[model samples]
Target: MASTAGIITPEWELPAGVQARLTTRAGGISQAPYDGFNLATHVGDNRTSVLANRRSLLRQLVGVRSVQWLTQVHSNWVVQAYGGAVVPVADAATTEQRGLACAVLTADCLPVLFCRDDGRQVAAAHAGWRGLADGILLHTLQQFPDPKRVLVYLAPCIGPSAFEVGPEVKAAFGWASGDCFIAGAGDRWLGNLQRLAAEQLLASGVRSISANTDCTVMNSERYFSYRRDGDSGRQASLIWIES
Candidate 1:
């Protein structure tokens, strides 16, 4: 596994040769707001800085041959990322080929990582409210031969205490009240993206699940939160198998 300054390494006991890491807002040359380690090219950051940050991140992963980046559209589309090319217009990606890593960029939105128990396959997803409601997780899980053998890691996201949503957002999930949703002022609600993901994964028969409790909105020093700071950088959650 790779380690950048303050990079969050998932604590799950993954199968041998399956490695994953969640990047934080630490380590890099991007300017203020993007400040230290901004890995995204969009959002008005300089291309040079973004590229340099990405290169710095890649250097930490010892055996990773290539990383398949994605132009996320907050949709349920899942693509097979076998080559080095970035999967365009997709929010989720999976791969069976070794040495090719799959990654998703996010700032407050949930980034989910998936791996099969045998370490032959891995996937990554960018699931905001819209993608989550539209079943991006399900779409990613369907790529695996057996969903039951899949293990999931829900990376950092906006917690329920900080993620305020309207009634339509709650209605989209077809739920009025649950542990994942908390009623707020008037018709507003606070939604837990992590819990919602875990519930959906459980319902799909996936038994091994690990999640980080870090709330991006609450932890501005360690993470980048879109809701808290508009026009911010995006961190990444990546997963891959060894060659």
Candidate 2:
């Protein structure tokens, strides 16, 4: 496990046969801004350094599968991956193939992972406001066998208190969003991306779920927050099978 400013590092755990980790600001090769431990190569982090950091991340986990990286345009698109598929571009990745790490990168946006309690399949999705509003989690849920049989684990992200949005962004959810948004000063609204994700999960039929309460924006010493600092590095929320 890596450490960022040492605030958050590999914080949560999935059930048996399922393995998961959320990276903080530590243990990487990138410079400041995209500082040490940044797993996102696309966020202006140098190519070689990002690759090296990713390699280092893999080295830390013995027997873990290579992470399936995504292009992540914030669309509702999701991809299905084989056990050997590595670094495919898509907002979400699902697998019946064991040992392949279904992963998503985030700096305030939501990264959600799901799997059947049986561990025969798994998935990860990148859901920023756009994707979340467009039903990305619901799309991922469609890939599951039984919604209630699937378990959801939310990785670290910008909390509602720190994630203020414009009315247009707030209107994206309409009434379906409900209390996911709270009043912010002026015309702004505080959106809880994590809670919105949970609502979507339940709507999609997922009954079991757990969320990481750490707010990336508020806890700057730990996870990265793109909202707080423009052009920031990204923390990875990843999951893979043990068998």
User: What TM-score does prediction 1 earn?
Assistant: 0.96
For 69-90, candidate 1 gives per-residue lDDT tens digits of 8888889999989665445779
Q: Pick the candidate with the highest TM-score.
A: 1
What is the number of backbone collisions in each predicted candidate, taken in the order shown? 0, 4
What C-alpha lDDT values do all the predictions have?
Answer: 0.88, 0.80
The global Cα lDDT (0 to 1) of model 2 is 0.80
Q: Model 2, 168: alpha-carbon shift in Å? A: 1.2
In model 1, what lDDT does residue 157 have?
93
Q: What lDDT score is found at residue 172 in candidate 1?
A: 89
Q: Clashes in model 1: which pairs? A: none
RMSD of each: 1.6, 2.5
The digit string of per-residue lDDT tens for model 2 on 49-78 reads: 888988877766545767778888988888
Error in Å for residue 231 of model 1: 1.0
